[model samples]
Target chain A: MTVTLAIDCMGGDHGPSVTIPAALHFLRADRKARIILVGRTEAIEPHLGTALAEFGERLRVHRASEVVGMDEPPAQAMRSKKDSSMRVAVDLVKSGDAQAAVSAGNTGALMAISRFVLKTLPGIDRPAICSTLPTLRGQTHVLDLGANVDCSPEHLLQFAIMGAMLVAAVEHNERPSVGLLNIGEEEIKGNETVKQAGELLRKSGLNFYGNVEGNDIYKGTVDVVVCDGFVGNVALKTSEGLAQMLATFLREQFSRNWMTKLAAIFAMSALKGFKHKVDSRRYNGASLLGLRGVVVKSHGSADAFAFEQAIWRAAEAARNRLIERITERMERERSAA
Target chain B: MTVTLAIDCMGGDHGPSVTIPAALHFLRADRKARIILVGRTEAIEPHLGTALAEFGERLRVHRASEVVGMDEPPAQAMRSKKDSSMRVAVDLVKSGDAQAAVSAGNTGALMAISRFVLKTLPGIDRPAICSTLPTLRGQTHVLDLGANVDCSPEHLLQFAIMGAMLVAAVEHNERPSVGLLNIGEEEIKGNETVKQAGELLRKSGLNFYGNVEGNDIYKGTVDVVVCDGFVGNVALKTSEGLAQMLATFLREQFSRNWMTKLAAIFAMSALKGFKHKVDSRRYNGASLLGLRGVVVKSHGSADAFAFEQAIWRAAEAARNRLIERITERMERERSAA
Candidate 1:
């Protein structure tokens, strides 16, 4: 099946400069994939160059008059910017012009717009932001990064189902293990909501791995880690902070003096290898799971290479029919109940 | 004033092997500080050696027959282990025989024992675990690390007051700026609890910095970051996981081959410097705030150097009369309300 992704060309910090190149690269690699570049004609055309003639109808451009500001409030963006690049990208997905939407726009606005446009799948109470993080055993998926601050026990259970289905679809795992994110591995650990979520997950028939702590996410103890958006967001940002600090500290150490600089040259390949192993760009895309259509949000400041990765991720999700899988699983769960 | 700290020597992973040596090192550094070693006499005597004679009566060993296991349940330890070293240590602080207590035992049990023996100060609803984390501009204190999972707006306010007083007493930062830990710095971010806590913080007359996100904790955006224990614990553990991943990756990179191993030797000093700067041992002690008597908990697996740092932190808090500061501040706030 051919996977088509609608790209928000006028979004993110770099806008068309990054998005256009990324989309072109993605198209060059995947012969069966198609892209609809949604943005202002003038802005996108300047970067398209010969790509329009090269790919013909496979690389099409759709005009979007408005652009959502990076810092625009979600409510304001949803209410005012009906024709925004982000909104149009989701619209393409909703209208069946594209199978999936990919945007590096304001996360809150993207989530709001996607939820407003596509709505959620049947039996799914809310859509969750699911993303993969580098771990010892490759990668693990975590959900509800910042979409819902106050999640009910049912919401957490829904996240688990969505996250597990996401891993199964994209990673092609039949029965992915899911772990509820908690302060402790003990069942008695965490607040009332988390405890109740743990109980719900235990009987949810989703290959539950009981409770896993924050460290378990990186340890790759389970395929899916589910938590409320508040805790998940804090955990994600905290990991980012530590990674930044380590990177800064390492850079400072390797560039401190002439001797260290010389050592850095000798150790350059090893350092590069280590850097490649933990590159954030490698895991650039986050899936907005439970939506009726697939929507992947890229980091706003992602470069062309990173944005391309997000496009590929969206293509993979689209080709694998992630939305249908989630819908089916939720329906199965509902029928079982 | 001479500060006396009751040490739970028969606790933690290494027990007296780590605790006794750490106490001796601490005593050597601080002439005005005294330590009362509370543990099994036989286990304590083997490590004390000449320290008993060298420090004279300033270093006394108060024997406790039982030891609290690292994995012991909090309620079980509190009920049946009355003579446990952890209990004895807190008992000393409660009786005013020691100004503060230092333990490297089970966190849940330590908190339970301390709360039972020392009790919460007037106007303070519950005790909080406050610890300093390494940041860009030195460090920032965060609470509660794992004490109170479900905190009300009023409880968060009490935590802010107690955390501020602890900083004032130990770090000597009067009117320290406190930031509520939320998903976003915006007023509309986070759950109802955090939103209400933010409101309470803003009007409570403390040096409030509004809301700060997870990365702000490392950016040193504020002097203190306040959050419920559940969120704080997850953030802390998540950081530990990331740090470990980076360290392991770096090691694997440097030891890949003979050529890289040679590079490792050349980069050893620079790497060592970087490691020292972010050493978890330097930020060892977590102060249990809002208790009537100051109680500091060290990491259960802390090395001698790390345990010594915890001792020094306990001494510093005791010397500054942390309990008195918290009591007075709570009393003042109560009268004002």
Candidate 2:
């Protein structure tokens, strides 16, 4: 079976300078995968070179006359940049031409375009951005990374259900424990929204694990951690900032003195392996759950290696039939209700 | 002009095992500083051996009959355990017997006890907790770390002002630019609360630097970064978790093989220095801002070294007249309005 991935070729900062090379790398690496590069032909052609000829019929281009700027407002971009690369890529997934769509563009624009073009699954109220974090125990999925910042209790309940479904389908957890991120672990400890959400989650009967504090994210106490976009975004970004800071600090420390330099040489292999394990780019892409079709958003600053990882991730999502599982779970939920 | 700090002798996990020894260390280190140990007399006397004779007059004790358990709710603890060490420490600050107070007890209980005793500073709606983070550039102050979880735009503006005052007084930033923590750097980005806060901050005539993203926290883009307690707490904890994870990953990598262990020896000095710089315990104390008196909350898990750092932080805050500066700033704002 040929798995076609629709690429938003003109997304991100460096555009085709990064995306074109990344697409070619994916195509060369995976024989079972086909690439549908969606963007302006002129912009993508120069970067394609002779590598584009090697793929032959497996590779194709869909010209998108318009491109959305990273700084453009989401609503304005959606209205004005109707034929933008992001829209074209999402449309391909919508029209069944591609099994999945990938973009490293303005996250808001990608989400908006995906939502408008692909539509939400039957019972999913809002589409959530779910990403896996390497924790002390293993890995945990955190949802609504920045989909809906001002989420209500109902929205949170929906996020919890969707996040659990995704974790169950992709992570193969039989009954994934869901935790609501709160200031304190106790039921009585959060703001009004959390209080209401806690009640709703309890009633939802979705393997609710009660409230988890900020520190619990690394502990991996639960399979799914649910929160509004505002809190989730802050948590995600803070983790990213701290990781970057630590890596930079280590580099500086290793170069500070002769002893440290010697230590660095002795620990070079270990350090490299450690860096490889924790590299954000290695896990650069996140699945946009609740969409009718499989859609993944690669990190904005993803390099070719990171982009390649994203391709693998997209393949995994497709192979797992994540959307089908979610639909089935929603249908079951409806019937149970 | 003897500066006295009321130490909560019966607080923290180890209680007097850590606090008494720490107080003795502080007393021996600084002759000009007076230490007022507030707790049960029987509990503190055993920890002070020879040091008691050397500073008999300088080291005083205030008898507090009750103890607040770490598990008790904040309100319940404050109401029922009026004579708790935390409350007694705050009472000393309020009564003018001490220049400041320090505690490692329940954070919520301390906040409530301090507010109940010292009262909020004029024109301040609520108190905020500000802590210093060691960044590459220097230390940065993040306000409302866990004070008010759900804050309004006006409350955030007040937090920004208080944070700026703190940076100026404590960090010595002459005109520290304050940044509103948001999902993106764009002024138009973030949720409704951030949007409203941005508008108010721009017109408040403060040295506002506009919206700052999560990645910019450690980059030292602004001297003071202000946000609601929920976001701030998540950011603080997430940064901590990431730092710990990175440290763990590095340790595991360095010890995995013999070659790496040899390299680790060479990198020991630089790595130790880096650890020293980023260690939270080295900067463990948090100031309870917007209160009429200075109160620094140390981490409950602090050791002797961390406690010493907290003592130094308290003395520095006292010497800098942080409370006085905040009071003056608030008065100026009122008069200007």
**Which candidate tops lDDT?**
1
Tens-digit lDDT string for candidate 1 (A1-337): 6878999998899999999999999999999989999999999999988998999889999999999999999899999999999999999999999999999999999999999999999988889999899998899999999999999999999999999998988899979999999989889999999999998898887999999988889989999999999999999998888788778888899899999999899999899999999999999999999999999999999999999999988998889889889989998888887
Write candidate 2's Cα lDDT for A1-337 as tens digits. Answer: 5789999988887788888898898888788899999999999999888866789888999999999988778898888888999999999998999989988898888898899889999988899998888877887889889888888888888788788877776677868999999887878777889899999888775899999877778878888999998889889987777777777888898887676777777777988889887877876888898999988888888887887777777777776777887888778766766
**How well is each residue in B113-168 modelled by candidate 2, as lDDT tens digits?**
99989899888999999988877687788988878989999899889888888777
Q: What is the DockQ of candidate 2?
A: 0.68
Instruction: For model 1, name the residue pairs that clash.
Output: none
Maximum-DockQ candidate = 1
- In the predicted model 2, the residue pairs found to clash are A259-B266, A260-B266, A260-B267, A263-B263, A263-B266, A263-B267, A266-B263, A267-B263
Q: How many clashes show up in model 1? A: 0
Docking class of 2: medium
Which candidate wins on TM-score? Answer: 1
